[model samples]
Target: MAFHAHPDDEALATGGTLARLAAEGHRVVIVVATDGVVRDAPGAALRARLDELRASAAVLGASRVEHLGYADSGHGAELYPDPPGRTRFVRADPREATARLAEIIRAEQASILLSYDVNGGYRHRDHLRVHEVGRLAAQQTGVRLLEATLPRELTVRAYTALEWTGLVSGHNRQALQHGFTPRAEITHRLDVRGYARQKRDALAAHGSQLRKGRVAPLVRLLIRLPAPVFGLALGREYFIEPGAARTGKPSRQIIPPAGQG
Candidate 1:
């Protein structure tokens, strides 16, 4: 099971891994914490985005997709008002969210729970909340937790270069510099170059988000890259599993052997 802060996050962070696992005949499930709606988008727009998410999940071969029934918590200094009765993911009670996720983990009998690192990738409020809730859920269900992250140094360098091009916002570049797990802390690096096409398709599915200016340019550029270039650039996904036994090389697969745990 992969738990993410928003609809597109699964695609951006772990889509390749998910697709590879699914193609290998493992049941893959995606659990998103928010509806990805901000600024009180029209009901039709919200529904359309959800539909796109479902399509993305299907293309990635996910067996199931679930939303944790929370609204998107917008970024930057000002917080957007919640849509009607819906609560922003960042404001929702952590315990409640943990319980909700734990129930799903138990039901799926999931052996692994993929979540965000301590800094929650780029430190979006919802992403940080995902880390908090995900850790609790993993503990509650006794599932092995793998925190999805990139090498902080690498991310900082990439963001710095992009920032110079005016592609990354000042706030976002700063966030990226501080987010992601340190290289020494990363325990796994899955080579997912083989699944680049699926990852691209999954990313393309989040049409609504790709239309938004804040993150659209980068997403569009990635999606438009040549398949080989995209694979070379985003082929490996980094992860950290605290207290996990590392007897051998970093795992290329998400799950460990059944008896090893």
Candidate 2:
């Protein structure tokens, strides 16, 4: 099971890895914490994003997808309050959120919980909440944990590429440089190049999310790239296991058995 902050986040962070695992016959599940509803947005938008999430999950070969019943914490210095009856994900109690996610982990008997690193891949509040909740949920359920993240240098390189296209300004680039894990901290670096098509298709399913953010252009550019180029740019996915050795090169697969995880 892969737990993320929002609908499209799974596609960006775990689409390739999930696709590869699903193709290999493992049952992959995508769990999101929020409905992607921002400030003053109509509540109906959540329904649309859920539909898109389902579409994206299908493209990645995921067997199931679910939301934890919360709304997005919009991107700004100040966080808005709950929308009607919905709780903003960032404002939701961590213990309650952890319990909710833990219930799913238990129900799924999830062997491994794929979560985000401590920095939540760019310091988004909702993403940080996801990391916090995911960690505690995994601990509560006794599931093996793998935190998804990019190497610091690769993250900077990606930001630089976006800066070149004017999608991410220097301020944004500097902020992103502080996210992701360092290379030495990485444990699993799966070569998902083979699943590029599935990954791209999954990413394309989040059209609504990809159409308006400052990083939208960067995402759109990725989707427009040729298959080979896309693979070269994002061929590998990285993760850090709680106690996995970082002695040699990172492991090629999530687990030793081809389909165990």
Candidate 3:
């Protein structure tokens, strides 16, 4: 099971692993925590993107796709500027969201649950909330949790690459001012090079979000890199597996549990 704050998130974060897992005959379901309709676009444009999400999910080979029906709290803006809104996920009760996620976990009998890291990777408020709710759901339901993270070394390399390529600008620097960490702490790497095409196809599905921009080309390049080169470049998909027995205090050595295969 994969839990994400929005539609494109799954493709960006775990499309490769999800595709690989489904190809290997494992049941992979995607639970989108929010509707992702809060982009800088018109209502019709958002609707089109929502449709694209479904198409992308099919291409990614998800066994099922479930939506928690929460509204996307536009990034960098409070969901409610005046009074609170019921649709805004960030404002929704945490326990309520967690229970909803727990129900999905129970229904699917998911042995492995994938979600974003504690920092929400780039600190999007909804993403962070999804991380919180996802953790609560996994804990309550006793499902194995996998937090998506970037290895520390790989993150540094990516940042370096962006800087060298002149892609990391003042805006990115300002965003990182909050703080950043090594991606390797999560510990599991899924090489998605083989599924890169599918991942790219999935990304392209989110047309509203993928407006003509510099980021699109960068994303395309990142996913299109050859598997070996990409692996050497990005290393692996970092993960933190919950409920695994530890020989020592929690460190970055965690691996997916045996049965998850």
lDDT of 1 by residue, 1-261 (tens): 999988888888999899888887788999999988878877887778778889999989999999989999987677888888789987889999999999999999997899999998988899999999989998788899999999999998887788888777676666776789877778899998999998988999999878885879888999998767899988899898978766566777766433443
Model 1, CA-based lDDT = 0.87
lDDT of candidate 2 over 150-190, digit per residue (tens):
99988888778766767778886676778988888999999
Give each prediction's root-mean-square deviation over alpha carbons.
2.2, 1.5, 4.0
For model 1, the superposed segments whose C-alpha errors exceed 4 Å read 245-249, 256-261
By TM-score, the better pick of 1 and 3 is 1
Off by over 4 Å in 2: 256-261
Better model by lDDT, 2 or 3?
Answer: 2
The stretch of ten residues in a row with the least summed lDDT in candidate 2 is 252-261
Q: What is the full ranking by lDDT, best candidate first? A: 1, 2, 3
Q: Which candidate, 2 or 3, has the higher TM-score?
A: 2
lDDT by residue for model 3 (105-221), tens: 998899789987777877888888988998899889988888886654555555666877775544554444443345424445566677766676777677756554446656666
TM-score of 3: 0.80
* Residue 106's lDDT in candidate 2: 93
